[model samples]
Target chain A: MITTAHQKIGTPSITTLSETIDNETSRSRIPGNTGIWVGIFCVLVEFLMLFSVYFIARIHNPEAFLNSPDKLLTIAGTTITLFLLSSGYCMVKAINAIRSDQSKTAFRWVNLAIILGFAYPIVKYFELSWYAQHGINVKGGIFFGTYYYLTLNHLVHVTWGLMGLIFVSYRTVKGGYTSESYSGLEAAALYWHTTDILWIVLFTFFYILR
Target chain B: MIGSAEKTWFILMGLTILGAVVGEAGNVGWPLTLSVVALIYIKSSIVIDHYMEMRSANQRIRNVLRLFIILVPMLVILSFAWGEEIRRFTTLS
Candidate 1:
């Protein structure tokens, strides 16, 4: 009689566990979380509108667009690009480490990302100072106007991402994530990567185009 | 084996360097414009696929991002190719 009851309970438990695993694997389609996706979509739409303005301006004044990169420092742009990409790579490593239950390694990666991420604003500060000294401000011309507005907008987004990283790193240190549950970390990573994508586009527009 | 993220990063870095060289090589023209546009498309796709992990995401999500990634660069190229016509049309009295 005891064996019969044990069998009944064990069978249902196994079945339910399998069903849960199946659901989880199937639902992994959404990266990070739905909330972050919504936010990212909004950000993308905003940038799309901004990009339209950039294209329109470029069409109306091709010469300005052509000459803009000559005035700007390509080294500044390249350095910032490398910093953002490295930071993004670090964030990915952190996520992979956490997914594999390597919490300490994940923590170290997150710290590295933060360190590299913070360097962006620092570089931008000097870049801006150099621009000012060289008379590259909004009043300089159409090109400078568009460049300042677009790049400043992107810098604001990167600032927000950096703040998110700080919070996520703190949460990570407090044992808030594990292999089974790291959605917060993933959400932070998605946001950072989105910023990285935006910067890449901006780099091409303001620095690389000639 | 190299991880996907590391590999993508290296590719992006390489392309970035190539873009700089192309931009600095000579006068601004169709070839430079087209190359930069292509580089933008490829870099964005890499970030979308590997960094954002959208490669395995749902079809709708993937399509939306891919469309965005393609559309912007296409428009930029179009503007570059036909900027004079667009400027004239917009400035019509």
Candidate 2:
């Protein structure tokens, strides 16, 4: 018996095949797509820079930071924080539901998330009005300036997140997301969660730690 | 049993209220400050882990997010502790 040494060069062995598949699965463990990850990175870097500035300003003007929180309405901050957390939790449920292929449940969750998201700007609107009535605008001092700058910057991002949520909810209702193909939905959820994370930091800095 | 994410939401709510109560006390001494920042750290972690689903993510991204949450609170502690020194080192005429 002659053993022919010819072997299929590119053919996958069971071990190699399983390893390759595991690698792909791990790669897919990233919650969203590459483009969304890049977007998330940009958002994170931008906020990181802003936070650095915040620390620098705090160092130089500790008094300003100390006095800033007292002037703020804790109720407003608390309301906003709860709203963000609730919305973020809804997004998580949305993703989890979609992963289980429960599109109806996911759609309901996404819509609930969006409605909760709209509460942020509404509370913000009242909060700003309170600031105005109290004569606490950006021009007040270093603290007010930093407060307005950071909070307003965060508000802009929230608006973007709200837009993303609205679009995602629309698609969710349209059966656009399946268990294996919810990258878009996940992308929006990721962005929404990022916004919520950023707001948590903002709330702590401005409202929690005096 | 309640879902994990819902459990996280409850924990976050508890922390938020705790922080607010401390802040509302209007006299944030050192111990209060420590607790506040710690709450900040924990809340951020819950969002990153449970909400964002970052636990099983690629190591690099997960590490980056963790590093960020840690760094922010650490900076808060540093500023509260040695702020004047940092200002001196950072100041330029």
Which structure among the candidates has the greatest TM-score? 2
Listed for each candidate, the true contacts retained, as a fraction, are 0.62, 0.77
Model 1, B1-93: lDDT tens digits are: 887777888998898888777767755778777887798889889988888777666667778888887888888788877878888877858
lDDT of 1 by residue, A16-82 (tens): 9999887766545787889998999999999999998888888888788877779888888888998
Q: What is the RMSD, in Å, between candidate 2 and the native fold over all Cα?
A: 5.3
Q: Could you tell me the lDDT of residue A41 within candidate 2?
A: 85
| DockQ of the two-chain complex in candidate 1 | 0.51
DockQ of each: 0.51, 0.57
Q: Provide interface RMSD per model, one decimal.
A: 2.2, 2.0
**How far out, in Å, is residue A54 in model 1?**
0.7
Q: What's the true lDDT of residue A122 in model 1? A: 97
lDDT per residue for candidate 2 within B2-51, as digits (tens), equals 97887999999998888889889887669877887788789988998888
Give, for candidate 1 chain A, the lowest lDDT window spanning 10 residues: A22-31
User: Could you estimate the TM-score for every candidate?
Assistant: 0.89, 0.89
